[model samples]
Target: MYRILIVDDEPMIRKGLQKLVEQSELPIESLRTAENGVVALQRIGEERPDFLFTDIRMPKMDGLELCARVAEMDADIQVVVISGFGDFEYAQKCVSYGVKEYLLKPVNIKGFQNVLEKLIRTKTKVSSETFVAVTKLEQWASRMEHAVWMLQEAELKGLISEILEELQAYKLKLNRVIDILQEIHTLLHQRLNVRDVYLMQGELELTGAADEQEAWCRFTAAVHGHLEELRAKRKGKLKDPVEEAKQYIETHLAEEVSLEEVADFIGLNPSYFSQLFKQSTQETFVQYRTRRRMEKAKKLLEQPQWRITDISGEVGYADHPHFTKTFKKYEGCLPSEYRQQMGIRT
Candidate 1:
């Protein structure tokens, strides 16, 4: 199903054409009408209709001019020109702008039917290609998720090699590949406690490669490096309860976690765990949690997209004012002031 927009100067013609399209039994999902090319351009921006039925001449911005503008924008919109004239020069102009169909006014029903059928067939073929693209991306995402789990288990060498191989297998466009990797990066933070505060927020801009193959190389290298660091941490000789506690805190930073909860989780008495944590980490549980939250706030401040209030809630302070007060105390400045000093602009 596709959306269609009908553009014309006359209300009667626009309504009539819309009715004809509705009764044509074509695969059109919806129909829209605009009085002139100017309004149609606005409709295109808003609705992004798949097909446009436009008149050649109109009061403000003729169809040819609209087509020219659309071509400059490089959007994937199919256009059919509706004209009162059957002139060869006008048809040539329409062809130059990649108009799919040029229909004469007082449209012949048979010709109109032929055009609709052709459009439906073309769209169906494109839809098939799109389905394949989506399926391939889904497979890539699944592989990346498995890789993250392997990282959590510290399967360092084998998992790293497999991840690089999987990156080579990616069939999607570079931008789509980047989006999937970013999603996986977020999962890495939540699941594996791979918290590079700067990278977690939008501080690190992953540069684009010359092509998909180059992109795969760069992306896999970065992932391999991050995982290697985690693997090193996991390769410690002695089991460290304090480190485990820190990992737990990072994994559940947004949740309402408590000292007793963490202590019980690692099979320790709250009192003894409290004393040990303070001795080892040199910070009380409450103070450590506040430090983690404030550090998270600073990282989030780097991302211009997130609101300060939203970052506050994300770091686990329900009340914005309370988060602000705590952030100021911890960072020696307000969150906004900190962001400004760090040269982050919204």
Candidate 2:
């Protein structure tokens, strides 16, 4: 999906280009029009579109100047020049500003569509190769949400640090990093709102930053500060967080539950929850959860009516072979072999 803005002084040209774009059957999330470079720059600053289509001749600021300004701020935006003049100097200026495609007015439908096709293909490839997928961001944000709720400052920092090390290693792009941070911020806000626990919502903006390092510094500072507030608000408030952790773990055994989420549910720091749970159960949290899952898997395997694959999923192991290996580790044989030894016939 893409957001494209058209900049042309002539209303007819803008409409024609917009129509052609609509007819391209491309994935266009938004199509906006600005009469000249100044308004286009204003819109670009507000939200960086994936592509900008502008005519060379315009009032106030020309397309050449707009391209230069965009390059100065965010060079990732692809600029396609639509000009009435074809002077060699204009071509040179556009090339200098990293303008990949330049179209002469009385725009040929085929040529224009070709440019659109090429840009979309290039963008799709760049997005796949360069940016982390939104789904991955969502998963990370899920963990961050849990960490924030649990007041696990260490876990929060660890998660953010891992992401920053990978994505911000080079100048990949700020928009992608901004998207991830904004997603995290939105999820945290929504989750906290659901609990009727509201805190100071700090500004999380990275689009205006020069690079992702600035984003990392600002995001970490803000989120860590929010964590301090959470710690203060819920300090020593839970009644027997260890027991709550146990109950949450027991109920979510069929799902891939984590210690962080369990601790988050009961509002205890993960390390503190680990020690408390071990003391209460005489087994580590991981040990207890695994033992319980194995116990349940064994009971399910005894029923010949349930398939081994289904039993594996019932015990939270999605991979049947891994479940078989684990079952061998626990029961000393394959599930089918165990059933046969027990004289259980299907």
Candidate 3:
């Protein structure tokens, strides 16, 4: 259903157009009218009608000016010009503005109907394109879900060669297939698709029994039902290592906490853990720890009992000036100002 706006200085002309449109079988969802170009502009801004019909001659502003304004704002809207004179210059101007249709004094119902039909057809084509794009996106998401489920459920090492062949036959990207396989291999602690593994006696040809198939089905069902839960658990575990690293920082706030030491405690390479921690929380591990320390500093500053130096050391700063700098960077104010704002003086 398309929305339409009619603009004309004459009330009779506007009413006539509205009646003719309302009588038509076209699926016009809404129709609005304005007495002049100024009012039309206001209506257009408010409603953003799909189609516009305006008379060439009007007080304050003419049809051409209104069309130009609408085009400047949103070129997607379709416009039709109506005029009392059969002026070629006016028709040329309308053409320049990309006006869809132009009609003289006595409007021809047939010509108007034809233009309306064309506009509706164009709108329908655009809608179809949007639907196709959405459909493709949904199909891609479903395929990814299926692939993840399959990799997590079965011990895919025995079926690697067959799976590779199937993926190739399905025209799946080689890189994507390899990445999925690598993730499964890492999590399951097995060298997938290795020549030695496949060549081992009875490894390649080990077929699952009916009981095994049933178990596989149950496992697949559980995975599908709890994939979101499993993902959350994995994310939580990823955070635990970072949390443990943070504990050491809390215990020795006055001293520096090296990234290497934190990574070693969490059984991860320093560079990789730094990258992973950033990816998970959208903050560098160092920055996050600094923020945590600053928050603690702020809370400690609220207490009248703690001295600035003591508070600074308690939150992991080796020097009072350094703590003030870090606090200003994170809190947008000096530590002393922050303490004052919190009604604490020491």
Candidate 4:
């Protein structure tokens, strides 16, 4: 199966080629079209196609520029230059760009089939070679899944290291390394998805790697980046201690809540919990509790039927004078002054 892009300014020829490819028994998974090289480059950058059927002449950017750019972008794509001109100059430029196949316009039905079959043969050969290691890759991917679940960093690196060593020792194609990395990336995300955590989205299409070693470098970089993301997400997992403490404090607003009790309730040391609470809420726990009590008192004061002393007791302050003092300190006025201003007679 392959994804192919047809790049031509003429809609008729593009559609015709698309129809022919579809009508035939070619293993085309996707067939997309772009009017010119400019559009083609954008599409290819986003999602590289397996085979490219592009005309030499196009507006805005021609096939020459597309071929040159694609060479720099990704060397793995199979590019075929289709031209009506049969121009030697264009053919030379295409060859220089490392395009091996060139078809004249008014493509002979037989020649077109031959070119496709040839590209498919080359593609299938490399693909089958990559598949020979599919079983091992699946086993490795399963191990990677477990390592990520356990948040084992060294294990992940060891797995990738062993894979790279084996790939190099066997002199296998870079596709095998790419496949393993891809499988690991997928498995890691699948595990995260089960946790309802969409940690990151990743794509690892290689630019023109200078050699197999460079390709491996790019692939491993991507693989390790995903691993790093997974580790970060794991560290951020579980219910936050600070949030649970805040909830408990809010619910027990009427009680004389101590930091030690709150810390013990959340299973953390008082000193560390105090520091964490301040860092997260940007306020000391005492300050937060005092403010919350005063807020509750203000609402209680709005009800004219509740006595001022009773309101104080309801907000965790049993002493009326102390409650009034604290309320004035926080709100710039006593609760009685607040009631008076709101025209709630006491």
Screening candidate 2 with a backbone cut-off below 3 angstroms (N, C-alpha, C), the clashing residue pairs are none
Local error of candidate 2 at 304, Å? 98
For model 2, residues 288-318, the per-residue Cα lDDT tens digits are: 8888888888788788788888988998899
> Who wins the lDDT comparison?
2
Q: Give the poorly placed runs of model 3, Cα more than 4 Å off.
A: 86-88, 129-346
| Winner by TM-score between candidate 2 and candidate 1 | 2
Please, what is the TM-score per model? 0.44, 0.60, 0.39, 0.56
Judged by TM-score, which candidate is best? Answer: 2
Model 2: worst 10 consecutive residues (lDDT sum): 197-206
lDDT of each: 0.69, 0.78, 0.63, 0.76
Error of 4 at 25 (Å): 2.2
In model 3, the worst 10-residue window by lDDT is: 200-209
Better of 1 and 2 by lDDT: 2
Write one digit per residue (lDDT tens) for candidate 4, span 1-346.
7889999999999998898788668777788999999999887755568899899888999999999988875345889998877564665688877799988878777878899988988888867764645567667767866776566768977987887777677554443455455665666566656666555545655543445676666666555545544554556745777888889999998899999899878665465567567767999999999988988888889989999999988888877889999999999997889999989988
Q: Please count the clashing residue pairs in each candidate, in the order shown.
A: 0, 0, 1, 0
Q: Which ten-residue region of model 4 has the weakest summed lDDT?
A: 171-180
